[model samples]
Target: MGNCIICGQDVDGRICQSHEEDVVFDFRGDSPDQLVRNRFYRGVVDGYADFGVFIDLSPNVTGLLHRSEIDGRLESLDWEAGDTVYVQVKSVRENGNVDLTSSIRQSEGEFRGTLIQERTEEKLPEEVEEGNGSERSDEGNGRERGTAESDGGGGAVETGVTTEAETETEEEPEPEPVETVSEPETAAPTAEPESEAESEPEPEAEAGAEPAAETETAAEPEPREATHSEIADLPDRVDELVRIEGEVVSARQTGGPTVFELRDETGVADCAAFVEAGVRAYPEIEIGDIVRLDGEVELRHDEIQVETEALVELEGDEAAEVERRLADAMTDRARPDELTLVAHDERLEAISGNLLDAAESIRRAVLESRPIVVRHGATADGYVAGVALERAILPLVREEHATSDAEYHYVNRRPLEDAVYGMNDATNDVTKMLQDRERHDEKLPLVVLAGTASTVESEDGLEMLGIYGADRIIVDAAPADPEIAAVTDVLVNPESDDALSTGALASSLATTLNSGVGDEIAHLPAVSYWEDTPQSYLDAARDAGFDEEHVTELREAVALEAYYQSYSEKRELIGDLLFGESEEAVAAAGAPEDVAAEESLAGHIATQFREKLDTEVETAQANTEESEAAGVSVAVLDTDSYTHKYDFPPTSLLLDELHRRSDAEVTIGIAMDKLWIRAETDLDLRAVALDAAENAPNAGISAAGLRECRIEFLSGAREEVEIAVIGAVTEQFD
Candidate 1:
């Protein structure tokens, strides 16, 4: 007996009542397998011709159908590796592999009936055919045979018939008899039909198709995913090669790669053209060179399309002329508008001729407009003009008896006297000649004269001596030796009239000692005293008490004496302290003993004291004389008290009296031993007053005995005082 799976009915050699069009079969062979209706699936064709159709099932693998298996309609389907299709399991082979199909064919009679029914709207073609023909006959025959076989020897049993016609014939012969034989087997109970229905569909197709798809798809790999841009543009993922052209704005070789900045009319990009050989192949390509390259478009940090294969340089100009012009403009713009030329000896020799010519040209240009002021010096016939020139020769000139070397003497003159002499003798001489030439003859054409002041003087003397009376002299203006006021007056115009004055000029020149030559040249010198003293010191002295001539002589002598004395005192002091007899005696006396030793010590000490006293005397005399010359009064107060011994309070009182009595608002008090004096008023008055007081009766203080002094004055009605003690005097007294 056999059971019909579709209807759960007991029968033998007869069909079950339920006959579904598409049914699944579970085939229990050596391996468990399943079979599904062929109509449920559609196959897809891919690149592999052997597998024209693809069946995708659980385990998610692809099943390939042979090209011959695909319906003829799909033979021309040009598919690729990444194609997809639908398929169903037709049957499971004994090998546990799938038999896939897109669709099943109906009998010829069923097909004709289906077409006629669609036209006439009659009952469904499948239903009409089921009634007319031997429906379920195939299934009946399959059940009958299965029953007979199970009953006979329990061998393999087949459920579905091979063909409907064969099943009909077999069923007719033994219908009743087979039914009776299968009734006992079919009568056994089984699980609910719905439960079986829900579970069977999935595994039925998968178990059969999965393995075949796995084998086929595994052999041929899937294509890679396309990039976003590529996906948006193309329907497939494939390697693409392209060519783009742009002008090379900049090119450089780095890390064996030629990086170029390429620019088209629309935009610019950084393109790297790597050449394995070397950059030498493109020798003509440089910065701003244009080039073209070919390579693959690869995605890097930001879709960097590199052309590492080949590159070629295009023809273009270097733009050298444009670059040169830009560089020149920048250089010219960076230069200062004004420059100061410092006149030095070496500089004079270098540009003397050019300076002279410039000065002459300037003089000629300005002569028609203004009268030139003449000063006494070499090249006195010419006048210097304030004008721009290529060069100004500065000739140094010196005085005949000047202790400095002749080479350091006469030179070109500064715009001012103070500036001329303020410079070193060599520089001063050069300045003096320029100033002299500028000041001398109003009609004399300007010419820069370069040399030391001594040279100018020597030349002038020689000229004067040589030609009885030479009226004209030619020389160059030493622009290198710039006078501050001259430079300022000619270049930067200051509002103060004092700027043009001799006093101002001296101050300006003094200010230039530390500043550069150009700054010093801004102001011209006022009094060009090339006689040796700094014009500033002379001017200060004249402003103090001396006349111009006396101040000049005094300043010159002081300056010269200071120079000599500085060296002399250093030598003398060194000798006396270190290598002289006094040092030896002091050392010897330290070890001496007895009366003879004491006498030696006493002699040394006394000699030292006397020497100190003499020095103090000289200093005190100078101070006293200076005070007296400035005017002050001397007074003496004698008392038993030690407080009054060296006090000059009385002198202060006297100064107060003098201030009250005279128009002077300030006074100076001097005190020495038991005498004191007060010089009240201005510098002149104080000097006179101090002289008179020192000579007064019973004062006892002389110019040589003065010990200390204090200056007392009223600054805007406020009382102020400063004291100065004579160190030499204090030492002598001690």
Candidate 2:
């Protein structure tokens, strides 16, 4: 017996079974039968052929290194005849032909240890043995002199061994079983040769136990069945067979095997089953089914996974027990301990309860493996709100799912053209979700509205989702209609009349969703405000390492990009602009020069934002007309003629810049069918629109959105609607 040089575990060779693949060997045998399959060897290049290279494993034993196994073109090899190379012995055919494949580790220095492969066994290099446990006993050598016959796969099942193998590894010097390479299931142990079995001495046994020789001749023992276990406990039971009862969260097939994400009361884990390469395993097992999985725990690439042997769906009381356990654990983990706001404000405090509910719903969706869809307006504040939640939710998604692309599959953000969740958007969402549910067995998504869908205009969309029993959460700064409160699962609209940007409200809710990202989203609320920034938010942003100037740049850069591709959610680009940190960006920008170009991308975009807004402001000021109405100074601009219809600065942004430059008591920018109003004094814009509609009954003037105090009117009644709006504005000042 020997201690494994790599892990210091007891073994028959210098390297343990767990790390046998990490070392390369020098083949000392002169026949193909002596060469072990799936073992890497050092060989001398004999010559090159048009189809492959012939490498000599020994003076008389040679193998063909096929071109198909080479990662690149066969002609790319720089090897010369007689040059030494490393290759894996893929197979030794019955016809005495050895098949070889290329090895990634070509140098002896890359391996932990090197051993000489003899006809019967492997031995460590003389120099390695000199320094590492040189003492060896005749009894140990006799005990270790046995063949580890292949189980028709890449694993070795020891034969001609009995007493030591029966004892546990921790107390005895038994050879640890070599794990099979991608085998479907563990095979039954094979008996030794009859000749060898008859030659072995009989063992003294207990009263009723059979003799060792007789036991060898008997049929192989039946495969052991596993007992139920928790998913979280699998890490401690590596290489041991166990059973787990859980609900399947997702089933994904990769190039190699089918991986099912199973969730139990404690946690979630990945269980892989293979029928063939890329073939779906256990097709009857689906997402949301309560099933019992029998598998051996193993670690692949440092992640724990179960190598499935059997999967059967449970029912009746068994299913109910698993479902109840999962629900209780999920509910406990989903609820946050307390809600913490980024900045102190009484308005946010008033809606703290709703914020908690929204956060809990989102967290629960993640634990239950439900996708979340966020809908927000295509504006700066809206994007800020949406991105804040995205940053908070993506980490949770990655932690909960075992797949690499879980973030992409679990969370989605859609930008709204207007600040209303109309029937068109609802229909699109419903159609896609229904298709996903039917085709992929996905659960209904939790729809989240940020800075949109809080008013009566979105009632139809809300009702559509409600009819399908989908979960809904509304987080907006605009006052929600009394009717919307009854429809949504959670409503987080403040009742205060003070200015509350959606970004500020959503940022607070984000912390409640995942407090780990609290520092990352602290500066978002400050970026949402166009002017009159809150002192508390400014302080928080500074504390989070973003100064006022940098925060302003982020806001402007986001606004410019939001307008360009108003419909598309540029998730990664927006995240980079807002946070200036992305592992994907760093990996793509490998070189220093490429990294330098990506640095401060938001600052460059903000510079363009300033130049374009300055040009639009200059143009709008030149075309403005000033007048007085009912002792109130009013300035109005014909936005349709003065501003570029499809340009960097939209009409709403032009109005804001123009209002900043004007000294008028009220600034109004009128387009062909819609108008935006900005006021220095308190004015109920919805009431003003109502008054105008009453004054000009045939004009069809109606309030559209509260964000910009926007009113929609029929293009044909342009003159009448404009006159009535001006009269109504003057009356508000009276």
Query: What would the TM-score be for candidate 2 when compared with the true structure?
Result: 0.69
- lDDT string for model 1 (1-734, tens) is 44443465674412233432332221211111323334232222212321244433321122445544666734355443223344445665544446666533322222111111111122332435443421211110112212222323576332212234544443222111111111233221111123333334433445445555544433422322212221112112113333334444444333123445443322334444432211322445554444444333443222243432344553334234433433454344322233223222232334334333333333322212111211221210111121111111111111111112111111212222111212243233333333323321112222222211212223332232123221222222221223322221121122231212222222222222113323322212212232343454344434434345433332222222222222121222222221122434455756443323323443454454334334433333333322222233332222222223232222322333333443322333332232233333112223422443443423322232111133222222111111221211222222
Give per-residue lDDT, candidate 2, residue 381: 96
lDDT by residue for model 2 (1-734), tens: 88877788988867777888888887655468888778888887754433467776764466888777888977578875546789999998776768898998889999888887765467867744542222210110111123343343798544434433443332222333333222324331222233443455655568997655644544454445576688777768876778888899877554344668888877778787755433567888878899887777775434677867567788889889888988899889998888888889889888778888899999999988888999998889999999999989999888786544457667989889888898999998898687556534567899999988888888999889989878999999988889898878899889896888999999999988899998889999999999988899999999988889988988999999999879778887997788866655544544344543234676778889999999999988898889988888889899899889999898887888889889998899888899888887777878989999998898788888766689999999887888789888878776
Off by over 4 Å in 1: 1-507, 510-680, 683-734
Which candidate wins on lDDT?
Answer: 2
Minimum summed lDDT over a 10-residue window in model 1 is located at: 379-388
Best by TM-score: 2
Give the alpha-carbon lDDT of every model.
0.29, 0.77
lDDT score, candidate 1, position 270:
40
Q: After superposition, how far is residue 23 of candidate 1 from its true place, in Å?
A: 99
